[model samples]
Target: MRKVCCIFIFCFSTYTTFAQNVASVNGKSISSKEFMWVYKKNHAGVTSASQQELADYLELYINFKLKVIDARANNLDADTAYKKEISGYESALKAQKKTSPKNIEYNFIMNEYREGVLMFNVSEKKIWSKVHDNEEKLLEFYNKNINQYNGNDFSDARGRVIGDYQQYLENEWIKTLRAKYTVKVNDDELKKLAKL
Candidate 1:
C-alpha cells in the first residue's frame, strides 16, 4: 500500500542518517563524513586503509571531539579574539570558494577550522599556560633535564624545555579529559567505514 511504502521510505532514510555518524562524544554526534575528511587528509597517498587504522583514527577523533566539547562548555568559543580569528579565516576561505553556503566541503572545512581554534584556545589555558606560568617548576624541570640540553642554560634552551613540559602537561590533561567525558562509538558504523 501507499502508506506502507511511505513508512518504509521514512524508516530507511532515518536509519541511513543515523548510520552515517561514527560516534557520540559528550552527546554530540561526530559524523563519518567528518572522520573521513580528517582521515583522508592525515593518511594522504594511501589508496586503502586497514580496520586497525580506521579504529585508531576513530579513537583520535573521539578524543578531539571531547576537547571541542570541553572548549565549548568552558565558553572559550565566545572570546572576542577567537571570534575575530574564526571570522577572518572563514572570510578568506569564502573568498576562495564561491560555493553554496550549504555545500558539504565548505561546512566540513568550517567545522574543522572552528573546532581547531576553540580547542587551541582551551589548550593554551589548560596546558601551555601552566607550563609557562610557573617559573620555579620550569626551572626545576630544566635543571632535572639539563643533561638533555647538552649543558645549554635554561634561558638559552627555554623553548625546547617548555615544549617538553607542554607535552607532559597535554598528556595529563588528556587523561583527565577521558575520565571526565563519556564517548560512545558505534561499532557497526565504524566497521562500515572500514569496508569503504
Candidate 2:
C-alpha cells in the first residue's frame, strides 16, 4: 500500500512539473519545444542563455507571434498564392540533393516556410499594397515633402516616397497588432530555458 502511494505521489509530481508552453498569444499556446528549436537555431545553439538574453528573445518572439496571429485572424494563410508559392518551394527542395533524411528537415523547413509566407502575404496586403497601389497617397506625400526632393515631381521622387511610406505603414501595422493581441509569457518556462 505504501509503494502504491509513493508511485501515485511521484506521478502527480511529474505531471505537475511538466510545462508545455513558453508563451501564449491570443490564447494559443506556443510550445516550449518549438521555442527552443527556433531560439537555438537562430542564436547558434546558445541553449544556456542568460536571463537578460532570454527576456530579450522572448519579447522578440512574442512580437513575431503577434504578427503571425494577426495573419491567421485575417485568414492570410488560406490564400491560393501562398499555397502555390509554398508548393514550389517544397518541390525545389525535394528536387535538390538533401543532406539529411527527407522527413525530418523537410518538415522543419516547410513549417518555417509556411510562417514566412504568411508574414509576407499579410504584410503585403496590409502595408506594401497601399504603397504600390495608391498613387494618391504617394502624390500627397511627395507634395508634403517637396523640399526634401530637390524640386522633383512625384514621378521622379516615387522611389524615395515609396520607401518612406512603406516604413510608416509598417510601423503603424506593428503598432496596431501589438494593441490588438495580448501576449502572455510563462515566466517559469522562460526561467527554465535560461538555466538550461
Best by TM-score: 1
lDDT (CA) per prediction: 0.84, 0.80
For residues 135-195, what per-residue lDDT tens digits would candidate 1 score against the true structure?
Answer: 8988998988889998889999988999988887777877888898877778788788888
Per-candidate TM-score against the hidden true structure: 0.77, 0.67
Residue 74 in model 1: lDDT: 95
Winning model by lDDT: 1
Off by over 4 Å in 1: 1-18, 45-47, 139-161
lDDT of 1 at 23: 81
Write candidate 2's Cα lDDT for 76-195 as tens digits: 878898789988988888778583335655676777788877887788788888888799998887887789899888888899999988887877877888788877778888888788
